[model samples]
Target: MEFSSWPQVPMINQKNYYTEFLKRDDQILALRLQQDERLNARKKAAVDIDRARAQAAQEGLPFLEPDPDLDEDEAMNDDDIDNYGSKTIVINVGSQNMRLGLATDALPKTVPMVIAKKAARSEAEDSEPRPKRVKLDEDAPSEEWFGEDFAREYNAMAQDFRTSRRGNKRRVLPNSRELVIKWNSTTPPERIPEHSDPLRIDWTELPANPAKAPDYIVGSAALRLPEKSKPRYQLYWPLRHGWLNEKEYDNRNMLERDFFLILEESIKNELGLTHKKDWNQYSCVFIVPDLYEKAFVTKVLDELIRDFGFQRVCFIQESLAATFGAGYGAACIIDMGAQKTSISCVEDGMVIEESRVNLKYGGYDVTETFAKMMLFDRLNYADFNLMRRHDFLLAEELKEGFTTMSDENITVQTYDFHLRASGQETRKYTFKIYDEGMLAPLGYFRPTIFDHSKKLIGRHKLIPRSVDLYNGHPNDPLSPAQLAVIAYVNQTIPSAVMPAPAKPARLMPTPMVSTPSKQRLLGLPAHLNGDKDATPLSSPAASPPAEDAGTPHPTGEDANGDEVGDLKGAQPDTEVMDRTVPIMPLEQAILTSIHHGSGADERRRREFMGSIMLIGGASKTPNLGPYLEMRLRAAVPQYPKEILVASPPRELDPAMLVWKGGSVFGKLRMTNDSWIGALEYDRLGARILNYKCLWHW
Candidate 1:
């Protein structure tokens, strides 16, 4: 059967089902055969032993008793058995691949990690050359396999043999003659296997010959393993959700559910340890979006703990994870993902909680807007039903051609309907739709300035009166509704942009008034503005200002006297007002988004500063690191020179940076224990609370 042609059959399930069944049946048959052979051998050995014992008894001499503890001593001499509970397995799961091995030792240094590259062919050479196939022994029987072909044929046949014999049935090939094979060319020079010993030949003819060997092998120069290396103490597990599972479902909750299921399956398959047995064996840390509530995470953890035997589960903030993974020294993470755009700030390894933000607009939203626009444009000539029919194809085309912010013209061929004057039947019409004024969705990230118009005088409190100016103007570029949408979208954009002071004027007097006191109490700079002086607000009070002033108060107000209505209360000291800003609950949601989004800026920041690591899948986006670096440079202009972003090696796992760092933390030889194991917590009970107090003391 042509399985590929059958769309109804899910490829993954079909492959797994057949493969697993065949493997099981093969194991059963092999086991049965082995058991029968072993039983016969045991019986023969028993007979020989009994005969020897009888001979001793008949000789009228008491048979000397063998050492009673011989079996115990033999068992002791065998390999030492380890407790299953103590064993640790490191499972590195990725979106496309999985790796599982023991955690006792670091990955083998000698193992080849080569990335295969396509051999480049010059355009001139490709155009000029045409190799003709040479006929060898044209008279030779075409059906018969040659001795030279035997090695190639046998290897292919052997693979087929193994595959075909996977089940209970087995078949043998008809031919059984050993043959030698060597590479041959019509030219004078010949090619042969380089090894001194010839590979054993087999009789069966293979279905296909292998490809020709390459002229050169490309790879890195081999290096020796380090002598005094630390043990492989970290275990990384990644899980991928196939697109097919949630392709039809647009519901976010349903998609998350599906993702969780796939993650569980991945963990089970890659770890070789079931959640039921091993979840409690080690600490499980989760880095997920804020949309997944703490209650939900707690519930999931509890279920895994109670039913699956998971003991300790830790929830790591996704943005923090991305920061750890990306190693973005001191920068913000701009994560553009399927559902949202997120921005997060990282300082060292910690995430700046207040600076994290999320924008609702994302790739999915852009796709949706594009679809609606296409529908609206087509409505001028075609029926809605017809448009819906072609919507999927249209979406696919847009997705393929769409660039972030390209200005290229896109034309799509679509069908339109027309009626003839003497119409007896409908006529099929073809039309080419030119997408006019279609800008790339990239503008969605920028600050939107729109004229607010169309207001029923004071109808809405939030709508300003000036918005009415653009009411009747058809060409007005700004749409208040769109602007509102943009604001809502901005809510979801991670808050990499710190809230600016309500009034910069208010802050001007702040430095002047506070400088003298800061100089006296905190030893701040005497000169309010000096080249060597750092921003007094950012520093701890004690740092002396680089410049010196003639008098503490330039305004001539007594140092002890209150200067009313002058520098005293002119600005309301709004810099202090930053503390009064209420925390947005939705801020958590944005933080979650940035955790999963990725860009180039985040990557560079991570690489350069080993202290800050980027974590989370979002931090893995292309160009995320660079974008973040640009934004950070713009946002925090004060520390332009001092600010440094880390640059990690390109080959490292950017998403797993935090997890790897966490694993490393677990192995640190610190005097103060950071982690509280489940057993200790359970045994101590309420006394665990006292542990925190003791630590502070």
Candidate 2:
């Protein structure tokens, strides 16, 4: 969603604040660790008692009672405070990954925001039900998988299938029951099947309602599927381009429901909470992209407060939170995510709305580039159309590895691929990627090396001019470097000289356009309403795709199943193996932001350059720090060769930095002045956020 202008804090001695904040955080972490040890000890003691009782029952001997001092209930009650019951939790929902934790914890627990669906079992397990447990929601699907658990399982299954098959065909047993699937609709699954055997069937039509019986697996359990049963399953990326709105799903509403459920499941599992009711005791903060629509933010807030039972909930802009986490007051932030890269200038701890740039070029683009190089160039695998999720994942792994190496020439040979053609012979080949092949990911920085007919270079100007408001000609002229220093000082010192007052406010204000309630459900732009051919927001087929699925998609195929990967026969002479998309190099993005700041005050351009901070998952690319420093030195020859190109601490992952910032914000000591209590939210609704969060901008 859009970031509102935040209230500026008095410019303090930042060096002292940073040191004190770190010291307090370390103390909190140390206390948390102590609590964890106590909990573990209690658990171990309980397990020992259970074991002793079982032995006594078997041998017909008297069981020894547990020590009275070791009573768990008493021990828990005796503690000064229960950290587990604490309401302060921070959640960073990235386009590709999620990081979550209590405010006191030193680091957030992270998981890839990938969910894989598995085929539902025909029957539930026949076990004695606990009467105290809450009944399942009849309308909702009971079984689902999510996050790292799902990724692990899906990867294992894909790997097993690759290792078990010969000539892209599994050896079928004669007596095994055939499990053929009959489709209810004409549209085939996105993935074409490799085996025709019934046991390895694609999808079987079922009489069950689509909402009640989901078709796919969510967590790591999807990988445990029997080898013969693997073909029946098709992995669905609910979040394709970083949103939870997969338009490909046959039931779009069902997909959205699953997304929320998966998110809730992650929270519950991570916190070790047993019941949804327990959520009422906690206050939660969600950090999301600034590009999110108001409608999406409203929907999420409503769901979290009403359905999820959170005591209090708040939202923070990702980059702003990252600014806090990185301990920067005013710095240009380049958040390189999975499907999007956002560059924004923060002046006086506020995001420069006019300078914010979001581009659909990120880690996935790099993965796709590396994948194409491996398939079409390195291995010469002709059937590029056959590539699936696994191929790109392997490419991404290699891409990360290559980014770390200093060698000009590198070899990647472990991955093997089996290309299959229906009713034709299967060809198997292994990738032996060399230097040229490894150059694919370098496109992230050097887009000039790739085709530019699509104008991938200029889509989102990495360097944009400051809006007229930020521009101010000094009353007294000064040198460029001196001006830059003055600008830096002006930004840092709250008591700095103020600009001359503008005209008084008008008596009558312009009326604001209020969006219709119905129009707010779908997170679409308001401009769509006037377009004659604009897709209806209500159309299930036009629903947006989910955002944070980090998995790579099959590139050649279009949404309507068109084959667009014809390299030889296509009229264009240049056979660019991958799609062309604009990407602002991190170095270029920083310099442009600096230039914009320099326009406002020339002296602070160096300050901004010296405090360049990188956040987001893509920022984790090995050598990114050094590479950006080098590129910045080259881009602006006048700037000092030695400039700070900093990131979060080495122990703190860049991807989780925003979440850590949220954790800091959620702390009562930090956010007492800003938090909108649960009662306030209930009293004012989403409108309260605009006022309380200072999001009016």
Cα lDDT computed for each candidate against the true fold: 0.32, 0.48
**Cα miss at 43, model 2 (Å)?**
39
Q: Write the per-residue lDDT of candidate 2 for residues 245-309, one digit (tens) a residue.
A: 43345564566566676577777777677698888888888776654545456667888888888
lDDT per residue as tens, model 1, 393-459: 2443454344322222222333333322111222333333333113214223231111011111112
Candidate achieving the largest TM-score: 2
Once fitted onto the true fold, the runs of candidate 1 whose alpha carbons sit more than 4 angstroms away are: 1-263, 269-275, 278-282, 288-293, 373-401, 406-440, 443-677, 680-697
Clashes of each: 60, 34
Question: What residue runs in model 2 are displaced by over 4 Å at the alpha carbon?
Answer: 1-85, 118-216, 219-231, 244-246, 249-252, 378-392, 404-431, 436-438, 447-583, 597-599
